[model samples]
Target: MTPTTEHRPQMSVEEFEELERHAPETVRLEFINGKVQVKAVTDGNHDQIVAWLQRLCMQHRPELWLYAERGMKVEAYRRGRARPDGVLAPFGFAKGHGDWSEAEGVLMTVEVTSHDADTHQRDRVEKPGGYAAAGIPVYLLVDREDRTVTVFSDPEDGRYRLQVNKPFGAVIDLPDPVNITLDTEPLEDLAT
Candidate 1:
């Protein structure tokens, strides 16, 4: 499980940034729903998958920019902000630090599950609902616990209407706006 340092009961964006700025380089944290949630320290295995996803996404569309560790700019309170494991933005969409990109136009947000139960819940439940509410077209979740990959699409009224899940080593087909099939073969080892 990821180590959590809950310094206070509720935190505003200002307070979250203050703590995040001074936090150690190794710490991975996100401001979600008035709470600051710490993520598990990333490992080499996790990093390898992230890097591979970036490269593979780029191959799918040279024009699109697939960014990692990009903070989701959600306008709603409490579930205000989230940092997706991988964020897909249109060509020239800002991915630079401090330049917040609105949730719209984000093609997809990927959440690779961690060992932490809190983090897992955040990924499986909180983030999907939040992303859908923001009208993001897609949410791809790599679930280590389930050893499967799920693609959520067609956001309608704060939820995804369609969800397709496939086990590792299978091909996950994405629909309109993002026409590509992601091969989950390489991710099989991470599931194990």
Candidate 2:
């Protein structure tokens, strides 16, 4: 049997975008799992973690750029909007795109867990389903609480078929399409 769309978004994508645009600069908003979520302001360590990954991506794949907090239309049927910590795509892929760009050319989406109560549900659970459903090639999660990197890939039927996890200091291969290897040693330093 084919899959079905069980739930509708709390508001249309247009309404969400308009609301997001008018929000105060300090407040970040996201639509996920049919709810308008106030995304927590990232901490310094979170920013540094993204930066380290950005440098590594640029070093290994000069043809690609890791756009920070790049808004993306994600989830099945593009029902959700997320500003991933890092969005890896071909250089200049979003040159002319608006705030919410299609997930079409995104090679990978990364999220570094924040010190928020909602992080476990939002990042560890809901986000993987959303990114997989959007057909993104890979979802890389840097879990600060766990000090582990979990890579989710091979999306099918709105779920990733593969998942690999490694501790902070271990080497992790991000896989094809996003063929960058990470020596996660630096992550250990950033986890604090």
Candidate 3:
């Protein structure tokens, strides 16, 4: 379920940013659904998956770059802040940006499920709402736990109108704005 902003936030956005800035390098922080969330550090396999996607993006869409751990202001009115595993945007998109960039011009936000208690809520639920609310075109979720790839697109009314899921070996086409087709066969060995 997409988290609702009905409840009061744990802290203001500025306060969250201050706490995040002082947080240790090992800890990644995100503010979503009016609450602060601790993001899990990427494991080796997770890093490999991101790198694999990075290579593919570079090859197929040379003008675009899959930026690793790029932070963005998500949710409606850009209230929530999230650091997606991979953020697909135009090359040099981060040139003049600070830690958190506006969601404008972002083609897609990618999240690879981590082995953590909140992975389901953070990656599958909250993120989709936040990204879609921000008008991001696509959200790609690589689920190591389920061994599947799910694509969320057609953002409308604070949610993705369409969702498509495929097993690791299947071919998945990331929809428009991020028009890259993926042969997820290479991801089979990297799921673990």
Candidate 2 to truth, TM: 0.95
Local distance difference test, each candidate: 0.79, 0.93, 0.95
lDDT of 1 by residue, 56-144 (tens): 87899888877887877653543467778888877777635473467877898888888776866688877888888888888898887
Candidate 2 wrong stretches, greater than 4 Å: 1-8
Model 3: per-residue Cα lDDT at residue 127: 98
Considering every candidate listed, which one attains the maximal lDDT? 3
Candidate 1's TM-score reads 0.86
The lDDT-based order of candidates, best leading, equals 3, 2, 1
Q: What is the per-residue lDDT of model 3 for residues 1-192, given as tens digits with 9 covering 90 to 100? A: 988667988899999999999999999999999999999999999999999999999999999999999989999899999999999999999998999999989999999999999999999999999999999999999999999999999999999999999999999999998898999998899888
Candidates in order: C-alpha RMSD to true structure: 5.1, 3.2, 3.1
Error of 1 at 173 (Å): 1.0
- Best of the two (1, 3) by TM-score: 3
Q: Which residue pairs of candidate 2 clash?
A: none
Instruction: Provide the global lDDT of candidate 1 against the true structure.
Output: 0.79
Give the Cα error of residue 73 in candidate 3, in Å: 0.2
State which candidate has the highest TM-score: 3
- 33: Cα error in model 2, Å: 1.4
Kindly give the number of clashing pairs for every candidate: 2, 0, 0
